[model samples]
Target chain A: MRYIKNPMEIEKTSFEIIGREMGEHNFTEAQLQIVKRVIHTTADFQYKDLLEISEGAIEAGKEALRNSPLIYTDTNMILSGINKRALGTLKGNAICYVNLEEVHKEAKEKSITRSMAAVEKACDENVDIFVFGNAPTALFKLRELIKEGKAKPKLIIAVPVGFVGASESKEGLEELNIPYITVRGRKGGSTVAASIVNALMYMIVER
Target chain B: MRYIKNPMEIEKTSFEIIGREMGEHNFTEAQLQIVKRVIHTTADFQYKDLLEISEGAIEAGKEALRNSPLIYTDTNMILSGINKRALGTLKGNAICYVNLEEVHKEAKEKSITRSMAAVEKACDENVDIFVFGNAPTALFKLRELIKEGKAKPKLIIAVPVGFVGASESKEGLEELNIPYITVRGRKGGSTVAASIVNALMYMIVER
Candidate 1:
């Protein structure tokens, strides 16, 4: 008949439950924060095993956050899920070009997804961080851009969720010689992607 | 290296994959649409067994959509994920009061969550449909309001995702003699909740 009513208490208790359920893991402090936040956003504890963080990936993400880096997301949902108030403290902004007129025109011309076109458009900008949540093609395109030496993001958070090419695109990201974090399967979403960014922001800003 | 590039084709292919993987189901035509869309958004097939829809729930939702309902959401992420173009065709609008000043004041005043406060504020509005995605407290509060005869909605899509009170709140909804659709456990999110609305809109508007 009763439960935690305060927002902070609810979040605190949720995290506590996550910590208790997860028990012990080999994740570093920063990686644990990202994993915990992801698991908190999604009640699935499988993220503990599915999430793969490259060596120093958290450090790279945190360093980029310290700078006023531009965070590019594949979907507006991810852009909406991000902690804007936290990003604002560091003078950073989250952007989603999927709905842009130029991106739409390019997608139609190339017969590609707007997600892919948006990533292509982002290649021209000074994007320091890339977050792909909805489209595998977007992650694949970003990997292609990186392979051609056109884009050099400090950190990439790729967790495109779907049955088609989601796992393969993340595998492509894992093969890249870049600092990145990704789920190893078809079990991630905008909420998980945004939670990672929020965890990174909270590490630097809220600390 | 090549895949479905056209956005419509990609969606069509994705739905085909879902249908193929799901094999056979006993869902009605309307229920199948909602289930397929949820599975499309989340690659998890457990939804096949997890989703619970009351009799005539889809009809209730469709009827509300036909009347230009004010769709109330618990989070901005869900409000952003909804297909605005489709909803616009029906003269329906999705609104989230989580960030409203009045809702914040009420939450602080009542010592409840902002999600619960937002639902309380929505109780005064002419809300035709209710969608709860991220907060179980909101669902519990709505169930309370309904129990007291304070509010009634044509259709309630309650799928609050978390480990805390998510399942219990949904169980509360099931106990009420109302037309509602919900995920049985802690396996739904804003994406799932928004996809249901989009599927319903697509059914009426695009068809």
Candidate 2:
């Protein structure tokens, strides 16, 4: 059978197929781009219904990207999967503190996960955008910090995946008065989180 | 609500929940571990039924890992996701050729993809274990080289994810006589591919 040999054509074809398969949707242009990119990454169409993009989340993310924000991710997988070239053009950088010595020491001392410790540490750095894709505890901690007025990220991309506290922690995002994008259930991962950021970067850089 | 705090305990609890939710299956002990890890990574239970492990595939993978063989992956995402510490313990290294200058030149010269060109270049290097997580074209090209008797990997983990050629390339693996592990449909990605390798390494190193 014939298929697209060029990488760019392959991705374009994949997006076309995703749009066709998704049929009708109420998502805005920005939301549709993020949803289509997530579906493209996983080949699972359920994301069409699962993704929740809060009001102004995409604009906030794009604005942050334009300012060369410090993008903090919960996992290195998300950091590695992000489009570095697009991010470089936008002057934004992605970082994960889960492997840091200070984060490890804090987790050990506080009897918390490295994910939680990393986010707690990140809160002090005035992170512009927060991306969580692995640990629900990190999301919960960030939520707590936000509620306490200790952390104030411009945009949050929370899609932590797991059996423990994943859905509940995401549901908690609804209570916060913050611009955020999240999956509605327990079906998200590092790829999904990174795809949202990449989609946002592509929106700005590619345009 | 209460939840796991320590990272090790969190992973242990997640696996226990997965085993409990998965209930009963026909997978062997090794196959079950691989499937559980995939499910853990994605929080998607579909992989329990979708994963296929040819006879001796896991054993072949473990044996190859033990020998410090070169693991060639189709994407840098997979390369970044693999457990570097465990692989270091085994003295093995993982490499992705998709971004190499020669691979890019070859793709442009031959009117093919960087993924396919990378695999073609790798065939000459005697790759021990081949892992394909992003490009179905790479998997197809590797299958072609193997059929031509130019490449003989000890084991192949083909789980490229996309709408085009993803399921077809994985289904094509059934036609080869080589030991392989794959997801039956288009529901796999870099994380799933890297999870299998990490699970195998954990089995050997953690034991």
Model 1 regions lying over 4 Å from their true place = none
Residue B6 in model 2: shift from native, Å? 1.1
Residue lDDT tens for model 2, A48-162: 9999999999999889999988999998889989988898888887889999999999999999999999999899999999999888999989998999999999999999898
Clashing residue pairs, backbone N/CA/C < 3 A, model 1: none
lDDT of 1 by residue, A21-78 (tens): 9978998878888999998887888899999999889999999999998999999999
Query: lDDT score, residue B119, model 1?
Result: 92
lDDT of 1 by residue, B1-207 (tens): 776566677678878889999987899988998999898887878898999899989888999999988999999999999998888889998899999999889898888899999998898996999999899899988989989998889999999888788888888575678899999988788999999999888889973
- Each model's fnat? 0.61, 0.80
Could you tell me which 10 consecutive residues in candidate 1 chain A have the lowest summed lDDT? A1-10
* TM-scores for the candidates: 0.96, 0.96
Clashing pairs in 2: none
Error of 2 at B70 (Å): 1.1
TM-score of model 1 (CA atoms):
0.96
